[model samples]
Every structure is written in structure tokens, then in C-alpha cells.
Target: MEAKAFDTRLFKRILKYTKPYKFRYYGVILFAVSLSVFAALRPYLLKQTVDEYIKPKDEYGLLFYVTIMGVVLILETFSSFFFVYWANLLGQDIIKDIRIKLFKHMLSFRTKYFDNTPVGQLVTRSVSDIEQIARIFSQGLFMIISDMLKMVVVLIFMFYMNWRLTWIVILAMPILVYITRIFQRKMQIAFEEVRNQVANMNTFVQERVTGMKIVQLFNREAIEYEKFKEINQKHNKAWIKTIFYNSIFFPIADIISSLTLGAVVLYGGFHILDGDKFTTFGDLFSYTMFIGMLFNPLRQIADKFNEMQMGMIAANRVFDILDSDKDVQLDGAKTANHFQGNIRFENVRFGYIENEEVLKGINLDVKKGETIAIVGATGAGKSTIINLLNRFYEINSGAIYVDNQNINDFKLESLRTQIAIVLQDVFLFADTIHNNITLNNAEITREEVIEAAKKIGVHKFIKSLPGGYDYDVKERGVMLSSGQRQLIAFLRAYVSNPSILILDEATSSIDTYSEELIQKATKKITKGRTSIIIAHRLATIVNSDKIIVMDKGQIVEEGTHQDLVTKEKGYYKNLYDSQFAVDLN
Candidate 1:
């Protein structure tokens, strides 16, 4: 598909949400139309009361005229209120529906999308943009309709009362229309600038707040503040431009209206004084009253048009998110069946980005209940191996199989549910210790949590805290040490009791004491399951059933610990010797 800056296709797609609320939308439209009719009728009724009843100079005529005026006021008030409520409700509901779709669509996007885009930009689109669109839908849209209907009705009444005076009002309209068109063009540019500035400012705030610790650690507070000042200045400039245009809009429009109103009054007054068939004081009064209202509606409608334009810009931004494609989806509609824990990767090639393969044409297999260790230098595609097995990213070539079926043929959820990964950089949610460990799954019993914790030996350290498992970990497990966080992550993964377990340097963050405890836990956890252990320390994988040494994107050696060491010039032997040599030094 060709890249579109704003998908016009989204408007039709978004109409699906309006389907459920069609009745409410219809009710709002009916009330709005009804309100417009009432508004249009009132001026004609006022003209009648002033010319026919009030001019007769009878006591009964004055009383009847005042009664008609009071009734018209009451009816207009009711209709105005009638439409406002449902119109607001419609806007709120549509906004809620659009926001939900955008949020869900964002979740379905590829990991690469998130990796490249800032979180703040996404958040701004979800919130501020939706709000702007809602305001236009609710207030601006209805007001524009009401004003246009009222203007049309008033023009007909103006011509009925006197064609000559109506012509005066008509002549001024083209000037008003020309000015409004020019103002709208300028406002659109101003509004777009404002939206872009807001997104940039949001990005600045999100990055600075999230990485505050890093900023402080590097002692770059002054530099960070300067950067923020630059963004803030840009935001202010956009706002000022919008305000400057606004400042001109009302004054210029008002001057035109005032000049037109003065001409109507001046010409009508002369006709009334000359005792000509051209005028009466009542006619002059009604003409000026109608002319005054003419430009009043125009001013409101023009301002609403500006608001609608701003909202369209925001809606376009929000729809961009809703239109993104889903990167990974389930297939074959199969439930995850139990496996014999056999895993084989047959000459798989993969990359984070196209043409930049991280794992190139490699094959490996692990037997049921056996532990396979992978060791290599940093950036040797070791972590990529675990990611492929977990199906976090799809391979570019070849296939990975569990039992006999290709992994891609299985449902994504089914494939992932069978595998558990403990990454080197463990992330813990900010919540109670128990919630973080159990991940709020009601199915996991306290006994299961305790068992995993005890097996990992973090249970004792957790108990030492004031609230034990109920203790709050603060943000990103910041309250606990890195080793403590890693231990809890291990417990979290093991508690799931997955058929395949991956420990990617799980104990590397821990101290000597925690390492020994975790090593023991690792052995217990890997038993009776297919496990892949990626480690930097040679001692950690010394007793694995098989060891694979990786270099660049290919596996260079595979054998048992001693067998690999016995091969004097092999990759695994070289790695093992270098580690011991560092210890001896």
C-alpha cells in the first residue's frame, strides 16, 4: 500500500462504531434540526409582534404581543437544551470508541514500531487528540449546522419584510465569505503547527522523566534543562501564532459587521422619516435586529469552523495509530497440546531488520529433559537464539519445530505458552511482591509461589522484608537489589512450570552467594524439561548435557564440557581456558 499521511479510509472504518449508537445519533440530529427551526421562527414572530400588535397602540394588543414574545423565548430555550445533551453524549461515546480502537491497535503493532517510536507521542495521540476531535464533534459540528439554518431562514424573512433592505444585507455577504476563507487557510496552518509542537513537548517530558536517574547520574542536569527549554520555546511559539490569528479574527469580522449594520440603520431611518411607502419604524427596527443577528451567527460559525479544522488534524493523528498493521497473529486455531520437549532448529536464519541477519544458517537440537548450554561473546546471536525459540521474532529462513509441527503453523499464544524465558535484563512490575511473582493469575496458589521462591532461595531474602511477599517493590523493582530482582524474576518464570525453560545469564547479576543459590535452583528447575542456558561464565555451564559455542551468527562447536575442553584448539576449549586463565591471574 502507498503511504498516506492521513488515511481517509479510516472515516468509513470508524463508522462501524457509530452503528451501535445510531439511534442516539439520530435523536441528536433530530433535536438539532428541531432547535434550528425554533431559532429561525423566533425572529419572524418578533417582527410580527413589533409591526402588527405593538404598533396598533391598543392595551389588549400590547398584552398579546408580550405573551407571544415570552412563549417564543421559552420554546427556544427548551430546544437549545434538548440538542445540547444528546450532542455531547454522542461526541463522548464516539471519542471513547475511537480511543479504545487506537489503544488496541497500538498493542497489535509490531515490536519494531514501538522500538522506533516514543511512548509520549503515542500517549498524546491517545489522549489530547481524541479530546480535540470530541469537542468538534459535540459543540462545533452542531453550532455550525444551527447557525447556517438560522442564516438561511433570516435571509428569507429579510426579503419578505423588504427586498431593498435585504439587498443591502446580501451585498455585504461576499466580503464576509472571502475574509472567512482566508482566515481558515491561515488557521489550518497554525493548528497543525500547534499539534506537532504538543507531540514534541510530550516526547520531551516522557523521555526526561523516565530517564531521570540516568540524567542525574551523568550530571547533565543543566544540559537536560536547556534541551527542555528549547522544546518549551517551540511549543510557546506555536501557541503564540495561533493566538495571534485568533486576535485578528474577531476584530476584523466585527469591523465588517459594524460597518454593514450602520449602513442598514442609516438608510432605513431616512425612509421612515420621509413618510415614503419604502419604510415604517417597526420595519426599520426589525431589519436592523435581523442584520445584527446575521453577522453574530457568522462569527460563531466561523470560530466553530476553526475548531473543526484543529480537530480534524488531531483525528488524523489518532487514525494513524488505528490503521497500523498487526505484526504477529495466531494461526491454525489449535490449542497448545503437551509436547515431549524435543526442540530442533533446522538451518534457521533471522534478523531484527531485513538484510541484517543476526542468526545465519544454524542448526541445533535438544532432547527431552536434557539441558543445552550456549556460550559466546557479546553480540554473538546467543540471545537471538532464545528469542527465536520463544518465537518473539520470526525467522527469515528454515524452520523450528517442537515435536513434528513447524512452530509457525501453531497458534502464537499456544507456542508461547509452552516456553518461559528469564532474560539477562529482568523487568519487574511495580506492585506487591506476591502480585509481581504470581502476575495476578488467580490460578496460582500460594503454595506454588512459595515452592518456586524456596527453590530459587529468594524466599528467605523476601521474608526478611517487612511485609514479605506482600511488600511493595516500587517502580521497576527499584526498591530491591539487582540480584534480588533477578531472583524474583526466576521465581516468576519457574512458577509457570513451562515445558521449555530458557535462562539467559539468569545468575550473572547476583553476587557469589546468590549465584550458588541460583545455580542450585537452576538445576532443579531444568530437570525433566528441555532447557537452554546462555551464559558468559564458563563455570555456570560446566555440567550441561551438551554445550554449543557460538561465534558471529554461527555455532562453531558442540560437545559435553570435558569433551570440548579436551579438544585443544576448539572454540569451547579456548573459551573455557581463557576463563580459568583469568581466574589464575
Candidate 2:
């Protein structure tokens, strides 16, 4: 993210996004040049009036010059308007494209990526940081180019009138340029600091708000508030350095500009008194206007360069995410439009982090339409099996097969579409219950949603809400009880009509009545589908076609409930007895 004096490569990459709107893109640039020419031309026209008309006392000549100058002003005004309009339009279009590409890239990433990265950090990159990149067109890169063009044209006019005066302006430029270089270097560091703090603040606020329930439940309101204040103070402190440098640099730039102008005036007057025929009042007048024009752009360049620097750095950050394709879900050429639901894991091994295996040398097979229940202690790798089966994260070694063919051979989308999952901690969006259930899938009709909910025995409860199916659930379904959200998640999985259904601690938190209803729903849905159920409650898995008891990522027992229960001190019997001893007996 460190930008050199000028990063041509990064700027070129940013420019690639402008291809879709090239008309506006090039139109803005053309306007920049025309406006600069117009700006330089006006001062020269006035010089002509002062020398060829005013000094000669020619009224007709003055009228003609006035009319021409007015025409130039009119053109400059229109050009300026178009320049601003096209520049902003081009900027907005580019960012819109970049944001879309970024989001799509993120969507293709494996769950491993999201597991490691903060959601708030991704949000900042997608939203605010991209907005800064837009400033490059509207106020940063192009604006700097336009200003430099203005200075170049103004210098041409000054040199054409009197070379010695042009020399004075050039001599004054290095002082201002030197100061600006120092200012820009300092500001780049400050702006980077500002961006980093902004991202930090966004991440902190988002995480706290999302977990406000935990914060309040733990009585940490005052502690959280103090933490927020500290972050806020750091954010302000980063901004203050930029403001301080700006306050110091601009005044110095102005004083140097004024001194240059004063020197030109003094030298020109003496030249005229010494009988140098080339120096004239008209020349002095034009040179004064040219000096102001020259220095004004120089002053603005410092600010514009800062904007460009920020945009470049922001662009680099965005590109980092785009280039991270190694972990993206690769779409295979093979298709699995309909899964036979025969799942197999042959010597599968994986870890979220390298060399730390969560599932080691795992081999599993579930015949089509069989229901397998996995019972384990916490972190015994029960859920890891489900994740591997779905290809949410890739295996480090070996392969998963569906219908005896490699799962990776199937197209990723087609493979996932046939699997539906309901988790213990259900997540719902801030939307109506209908939208949350269907996830805004246009293909899933409202009637279909109702039917699925009815199948899961939650339709009556949903209808009991104020808006029935239309009731807004709010963030993470906070408006409803945890059991109610679980019901909605169950309904979501049911509506998919997947070949393979998974319940990962799905009924662990359900109330007795809801649990009974879901049990009924579970039987109905799992009747002819391959099902994987992970549970801590041993009672819930008693009817499983096969129950696998695991410990420390290895299977210790596998059998029907009665067979394992009869074994003395067997893993399954131990778990069953522990639960019975706790309450169920």
C-alpha cells in the first residue's frame, strides 16, 4: 500500500475500470485541456486590450477586445461545467463496477476466508474505502492534471510577453515546490494513518453493535463506552496531523507567490524607467494575472496530490482482495443437478489452520436415504464432517465423493444446491420472515414458503405474528425467540428439498414442544433423504440408523443405539449414561 512518487502501474489498473464509460472518461479530459487554454487565453486577450487599445485610446479597438474576451469567458464557463459533470459521472461509474467485482470475488471465497477475516473490515473495504477512490476522478488525479495544464499555458503567455519576467516566476516555483513536496510526504503518512483508524473504528463499532446483547448481558456498557471513546480519540488525532500540515503549508505557498509577483512588478517598473522598450504596462498587467494563475494551481496541486495518494492506496487495498483467488471455490466443469445422496469421505484430512488437523484421516460412508447420527463431546469434530461433506472448506488430503464420483468433479454450485443445513444458532437478516426464509430467492414463491413452514409445523406460529409471514424479524432474528428463529431456519432448509439434509445441534436449544414438532418434521424430511445429525443430547439420536461415538477426532464406537448401549463402558453407552444421569433417566 506504500505509494511511490507516482504509481503508474496502480493508476493504470484503476483506469481499466473506466472502459465501460469511456465516452464520459475521455470527455472530461478533453474539457480539462480546453478549459486550461481558455483560462490562459483570457489573460492574453486583456493584455492585447491594454496595449493595442487602451494605451492608444481607441474606443472601437476596446469594444472589439471586450467582445472577444466575453466570448472566451462564455466558453470557459461551459467547459468548466461539463468538466465537473463528466468527471463525477466517470468516477461514480468506475467505483460502481469495482464494488460489484469486489463483492462477487468475496462471494467465491471459501468459508475459511470469512472465518479468518473480520466482517466489519470487509464492509469498510467495500464501502468507505471505495468512496475515497472515487475522489481520484472528481478531485484528485484529473483535477491535478487540469491545474498543471493551466500553469503550463499561463507560463507560455508570460514567456511570450517577457522572458525575464517568466524567469522570476520560474525562480519562485522551486521554493513552493520544495515546500509542497515536504507537505505531500507528511500528508501521505497522515492520510494513511487516517484511513487505518477509520477502518479500525468501523470494525470496532460493527463488532460491538452485533454483539450488543453479550455486552449488555455481561453488564459491560460503561467499559465498552470507554473503549469506543479511546478509538474515537485516536481517529481524531490521526485527522489533526493532516489539518496541522495544511495550515502550515498554504500560508507559506501564498507568501512566496506574492513575493514573486512583487519582484516582477518592481523589476518591470525599473526596466521601463531605464528605457527598455520591451517592458510595457500591458505586459505587467498580463504578467500579474499570469503569476496568480501560475501559483494558484501550484497551491492546489498539493491538496489534489494528497487525494490521489489516498485513492492509490485505497485502490491497492481493494485489489488485494480481488487478487486472492487461491482459496476461491473453483467451479468444475462437471454437473450434479440431482445428487443421489451417496456421500463418502475417503481418508479425508483437514484443518482450518495448517498442520493442526481438526479431522484426521477420516473415512466415512452414508448410503443414499440413510440417517447417520454423530454424537461427540465439544470440539470432537462432529460439525467438521458436515462442513467437509458440503465442500465449504477444502480437504488438505484425500477426496469426498457423491454417488462414487469425486465431489470436486461436480460444479460447486450444483453440489451445494443439493445440500440443506439447519444450525443451532440460526442467522436471519433484517427483513420480513418470508424473505429470510426464502432468502429473497425469486424462484421460491410465497405459497411455497408457507407450505414448507407448514411441513415443519411452524406455519401456525408464524401466522400468529403481526404480519404473519411478512413480519420483520430484525437483525439476526432478535425480534423472535431463539427457538422461533430455529424453526424459521428449519423451514428454510425444508423448502430447498435437498437430497442431503443436516441438523448440526439443530434441536439442542429448542423448547420441548418445538422440539417435538421438529422431531416430527425431521422424520418427515429424512424419510428418503441422506441425513447427517450432530448432537450432544444422546436421547435425540437413539433412533438413528447408525450412531457414531467420537472422541478427540476419532471414532470410538459405531452401531445401532441398543447395540452400543449394551456394551460395558462403551463410548456410546458412556455418553448415554452421562445424559441419563444428568436428567433424562
Top TM-score hit: 2
Minimum summed lDDT over a 10-residue window in model 2 is located at 1-10
Candidate 2 global lDDT: 0.90
Each candidate's lDDT (Cα)?
0.81, 0.90
Could you tell me every candidate's TM-score relative to the true structure? 0.92, 0.97
Best by lDDT: 2
Clashes of 1: 0
Clashing pairs for predicted structure model 1, backbone only: none
The digit string of per-residue lDDT tens for model 1 on 29-137 reads 7766666666666666767777777777666876887787678778878877867887778778989988887887776565667877899999899999999887765
Model 2: runs farther than 4 Å from truth?
A: 1-3, 273-275
What global local distance difference test value does model 1 have? 0.81
